[model samples]
Target: MTNETKIPNTRWWRILPATVLVYIVANIDRANISFAMAGGMMEDLGLDAVAIGMAIGIFFWGYLLLQVPGGHLAERKSAKHFIAAMIVIWGGCATICGFISTSFEFNVVRFILGIAEGGIFPAILVIISHWFPPAERARANSIFLLSFPLSAIISGPISGWLIATWGWREMFIIEGVASIALIFLWMPLIADRPSKAKWLSAEERNWIESELAAEAAAKKAAAATNKSATKTSYRELVFDINLWKMVAVYFLICCAFYVLSFWLPTIIKDILKADIGMVGWLSALPNIAAALGIVFFGRMADKSQNRRKYCIIPYVCVGLCIIASVFTASYSGWLSFAFLCLCGFFWLSGHPVLWTIVAETFQPEVAGGARGAINALGNLSGFFAPMLLGYMIQNYSRDAGMYIFAVLVFLAAVIVWSMPKNAETKAAVEKTREHVAATTNAHA
Candidate 1:
C-alpha cells in the first residue's frame, strides 16, 4: 500500500476546527469595537470620529510589537504554548475594554489588545505550515482563514443583539470571557507538529513526518544552489527585494481590507438608514458572501496551483467592486450593498492564496520570520486606513476614502502580477505540483 493510503486525513478533523474556533473568538474580540462605536460608545465616551479612529488605529501600533518574535517563537519553541499564552493575554485585554469610560482609556486598552492579538496570526500560520504539506496548504489555509469572515458572520448579529439588549459594555465582557474560556480546548487539542500529536495514529504520524522531511530536504538542496535562499538572517531577509515586494502588495491589500472591516457597519447603516440591529444583519451579508468566495477560490487555487493568477484576479475584482460601490451608493442603496458584497467576496478570497504564495516562496526554516515580517508590515495599514478614512469622512466625503482604497487595491494587483518569479519559488512550485500528482495517483 502507498504511504498516502496508510495515512488517515485526521489533521483536518483534529487541527482545523480547533484553530478555527480559536481565531473566531480572537477576531470577534478585535472587531466588536465596531459594534460598540455604532451602538453608542462614542456618545458614552464623549469622543469624536477622529478620536474613535485613533482608538481603533492604536491597536495596530501595539500589534506591531510581537509579530516577529511570536512567529519565531512558534517556530523554534512551540506554537501550541505560544498561542495559548497569547489567548489569555488578549482575552484579558478584551475584557478590560468593557470598563473603560474615557477615550484615552479605550485607546490604551485597545493598544494592549492589539499587542496581545498581533502574534496570533503568524503563529497560526506557522502551526499550519507544520501540519499541512504543500499539496493541501492552500485549502488548509482557506479553511483556517474562514475564521475571518465567519467571525464577522457570527459576531455581527450576535454582537448587535447583545449591544441592543444589554449595551456594548456587556457585549465586550461576554465575548472576552468566552475567549479566555477557549484556552482549555486549545491546550488539549493542539500539538506543535504531527510527531507531538498524541491523537494521530502511528502510521499517520510517520507519513506526515516523512513527507515533511522530504520537502524540507528538497528546500535545503534548492537553497544550496540559490544565493537568495542562502540569506535567511533577519538583516538579510529585511534587505531582500522580493520580500519587500510582498510586503508592499500585502500592505495595499490590507489598506482596503481594514477599511472594509472597520467601517462596513457604518456604511451599511448610512445606506439603509436602518437601526443598529438591522445594520448588523445587513453588514453580515457581505461577509457571508466573503465566506463562500474564500471556500470556492481556495479550492480553485489548490486545484490549479497557480497562486499568482488567483491572487491577482481576486484583487482586480475587489478594486472594481469597491469603486463600483462608491458610484452606486448615490443611486441605489441596495445596489451599493450588492457591490459591497462583491467587494468582500473578492477581498477576502485573495488572502489565503496570497499567503500560499508566501509559504511557497520561503523555506520552512525562515517561513515564520518571513511571514511575521510580511504580516507586520502589511498590517500597518490597519492603523493608517481607518484613521485616514475617518478623517476623509469627516472633512471630505466617504466616497473619497473608498476611492483611495480602490486605487490601493488595484496597485496591489499590479504588484502581484509583476512580481519576479525567483529560482526558489519556481523550485517550490515544481515540487508542490509533483507532490500533488503523486498523492493523486496514490489515491487513485
Candidate 2:
C-alpha cells in the first residue's frame, strides 16, 4: 500500500496544470498577433487586408513542414529538453516580432515561430498518451486542448489593454518573456516516461506500468479481434485513406478556427466601431463561449459511446451558427456577434472529439507522429484560411468568409458521420488493407 496507490488522481493535478500552462502561452504567442493587428501594428506597418492575412497565415507554413520530423525527434530524444528548448526559441521569436518594421520581417518571424511552436502539441500528446491509461486519456487530452480557448479568452482583453496602453511591442515582448520563463518550471517538473517519474512510489510505478501494458495488450487484442487493423508504419500512415479523411476533417475545422481567431477583433470593431481597449474586451466574448464549449464537449465526447454522433453535433452547430450569423448580421450587430460566439463555441469543441477519434485510429507506436501529421496537414488550414478570408473580406464583405466556413465545416461533419470507427483498432488495419487494394485497382 504505497502512497502512489493511495493517490492515483494526484499526478493528474501536477501534470494537467503544467501542460495547460505551456499551451496557454503557446496559444497566446500564436494568437496575440490578431490583437496587435487590430491595435496599431497594421497602420504602423502600412499593411493592407491581404497582407495582414498573409502575415497571420504564414506561421502555419513552416509549422507544416516540421510535423513528422519534430514528432520523430521528440519520440526519439528527450521530450523535456526538446520541448523546453523549442519554447525558449519561440519565446525569442515572439519577442523579436514586436520590433519588426516591414512586412518581410513580420512574416519571417511568424514562420520561424511556427517552426518552433509546431512540435509542442504533438509531443505533449505523446507525453499524455504515456502518463494516462486509455480510460483517462481522452479527458486529459480535452483538458490539454481546453487551454487554447482559455488562453484565447485571457489574451483578448490583456493584449488589447497592453496594446492600448503600452503598445503592441510591449504585448509581444511581455508574452514572449513569460513563455521563456516557463522553461525553468518545465525542465524540473516533467518526466519523459512513467518509470522516470521520481515522485511516484515503486508500487505506484508498477501499477501505472502494468495498467498501460494491459491497455496495450487490450488494444492489441482488439486489433486481433478486428482482423489486424493494428499493423502500421510510416508508409501506411501516409497512404491510409482513413488518416487522410481525418486530415481533411481537421483542415476544415482549422479553416473556421483560424479565421475566427485572426479576424474576430476586426469584425467586432467594425460592428461596434470600438477603440482598441473596447475591442479587446468585446473580442473576449466569443472566447468565453468557446472555453465553455471546450469543457462541455470534452465531457460529452468522453461519456458518449458513439464517437461519430458526439463529434458531428458540434461541427454541425459550427456550420449552422456561422451561416446564421451571416444572415443575422443584416438586422442586428449584437445578434450577429452572438451567432458568431455560438460558432466559436462549436468550432473549438470539435477538436477534443476529433483527436479522440484520431487516438483510437492510430496505434501507439505511431500516434505521436500521426498527431504531428494530422496537426501539420490540418493546420495548413491556418495558412489558407486567413488568406481566403482576407480575400473575401477584401473583395466582398466582412461576413462573406463565414459562408465558406459554414459549408466546409458542414461537409466535415458529413465526413465524420460517414467514417468507420476503429472497431477496436482492427478496423484501422482493415482500412489500410482496403486502401491499398483500392489504390492498386485504380492504378491497374
In candidate 2, where is summed lDDT lowest over 10 consecutive residues?
426-435
What is the lDDT of every predicted structure here?
0.86, 0.80
TM-score of each: 0.94, 0.91
lDDT of 1 by residue, 1-444 (tens): 233545699999989999999999999998889999899998999978788789888999998998889889988999888889989999999999999988889989999999999899999999998888766788999999899999999999999999999999999999999999999999988899988888898877766665676566556666755544666677787777778889999999999988899888888988879899998888888898889989988999888777888888999999999999999998999999999998888888889988887876666667798988899989999899999998998999989989999999999999988874444544664675567558757877
- Give the runs in model 2 whose Cα sits over 4 Å from its true position: 1-7, 224-228, 422-444
The local distance difference test score of model 1 is 0.86
In model 1, state the lDDT of residue 155: 92
Q: State the displacement of the C-alpha of residue 332, model 2, in Å, after optimal TM-score superposition.
A: 1.2
> What would the per-residue lDDT of candidate 2 be over residues 1-444, giving only the tens digit for each residue?
212336466558767788888999999999998999888899999999899889998999978876877777767666677789889999999999888989999999999999999888888877777787554566778788878888988998899989888999999999988889999888777887878888876655665665566555555657655422474678767777778888899999888888888888888887767888988888877877877887887777666535677679998999899888888776888998888887877777878777777766666767778889989999999889998888988799767778888899999999898788644553333444345446556876
Q: Can you give the lDDT of residue 273 in candidate 1?
A: 91
